[model samples]
Target: MPPRSAPTARQRRLGAELRKLRDSVGLSSTEAALRLKITQSRLSAIEGGRYGVSAERVRAFARLYDCRDAALVDALAGMTAPRRRNWWEEYRELLPAGLLDLAELEHHARTIRTAQVTHLPGLLQTVDYARTIFRQTIPELPPPMVEYRTSHRIKRQQVFWAHPPKPYSATIHEAALRMRFGGRQITREQLAHIVTMSERDHVTVRVIPFEAGSFPGAGQTVLYAEGTVPQLDTVQLDTEHGSEQLHSNAQLDKYRTFLDRFEAIALTPSASRGFINQILKAL
Candidate 1:
């Protein structure tokens, strides 16, 4: 296949890992290419994610690198396999690349865990909640753009709302539920939606009330997307700018611990539902 002008974030991540393995063995690009019996430019392209690598080739690279972890190798090889076009692809041109990348990550996650402070988790927001948030975008988005963002966000939720949904856990703050994004009615509806979703078989929604006191990463949001195996786990964070994806062992470890701490201070699923219900009643 011809080289893609812009490879997806996941694809670049796969290539980056391969390059790290080669570096760990103290091999120069030329030497690694020579060992793999591929041209130097070909090696560069593969490492840059401009070219696709096969599962067989990934295994061969692991062997040459003397990587002893079978599980890690298997996970890496899985990344090399071709994937089907997901629903996110349809909005490739309409939305930001980060949004598409997020959707793709969630599509393959074995389990999903997230926490949001001021805003509800994108994967859990209702149509009105999502539209209200997008409608307030900086510089004021055009009507078409707002609808595009709303549409893409709703589609992302399909992973949980679809048949045989993936295991999901969302830790939200009381302030987020009471923010009144579209007004009292909308916020009440959003909270009610969260209550409904929490009752789903594969979903768990926990809330951190103001009474819980302070917590780590005070205002930041976190989305931990577990891969088929531990080695492929990812942590996606929402920032003042666009979203950021973290794949390193250290970053994932830190965020996982952070989330664990956050959840510890949060209300239990049952109590959280009651808290939301009370808030909805007042609204």
Candidate 2:
């Protein structure tokens, strides 16, 4: 088997910061590379998130860019530094790049808020529910692939319940509640699971009712994760082609607004729990 690819979230973040700094300084990669005494190709690699740059090199680049804040430079240096291997590494070969990226982001996130229109959020999905969803994919994935995907998803859910658990809030649409992924029994279990999860101090689940009608989401799901440091939140969206990360202030604001609007239309926690119980009893 081939060696697994490295998780690109950290590298991608470093690349983004480098580009931002360069742009802020009005220097192209070639200009920056000339000043840093490195070849344009190497600088391009760093800015493109394909290569890892050393902390010293990062500081030097910050200095060359005339970035005045020592703390900001130090934070970038820390972010660019190598991270210890995480258990998710073991499943790299079995999971999609997008899923792996999401898991890594979750591992580092101080808080995660998600809005889903058609399905339960992965962090809140039961094993059986995940398996059913995977098996229903259009291309008809092989049984082994389905099993692997399901297991990978379940493993990702561990972050929500890990020691010193991270905060998670999911706003799900009422449409998702009506769609039975596995069967009546599995749907019942899934709803019960949601009730149990909502009991956690750090977990909040809200439901957007069908009657709410035409909210900001408009058939999209988004995840906004707060990083270890402020100003490092990441917004992720799922598309038909793949996943896209949004980091710019405008993009992040757009999603944040969307989430806020969705929340406005969503049932409050107490009402959501009541709806969930109703579903469970009906099932």
Best by TM-score: 1
lDDT of 2 by residue, 214-262 (tens): 8785678899988755557799887877677878878877888888888
Clashing pairs in 2: none
Report the backbone clash tally of model 2.
0
TM-score of 2: 0.92
> lDDT tens digits, residues 67-163, model 1?
8889889988988878578888888888889999999899878899998899999988989899999988887899999999999999888898656
Q: Give me candidate 1's TM-score against the actual structure.
A: 0.96
Write down the TM-score of every candidate: 0.96, 0.92
lDDT of 2 at 32: 87
Clashing residue pair totals per candidate (backbone < 3 A)? 0, 0
Output candidate 2 Cα RMSD: 2.8
- Top model by lDDT, which number? 1
Worst 10 residues of 1 by lDDT: 156-165
| lDDT agreement of model 1 with the native | 0.89
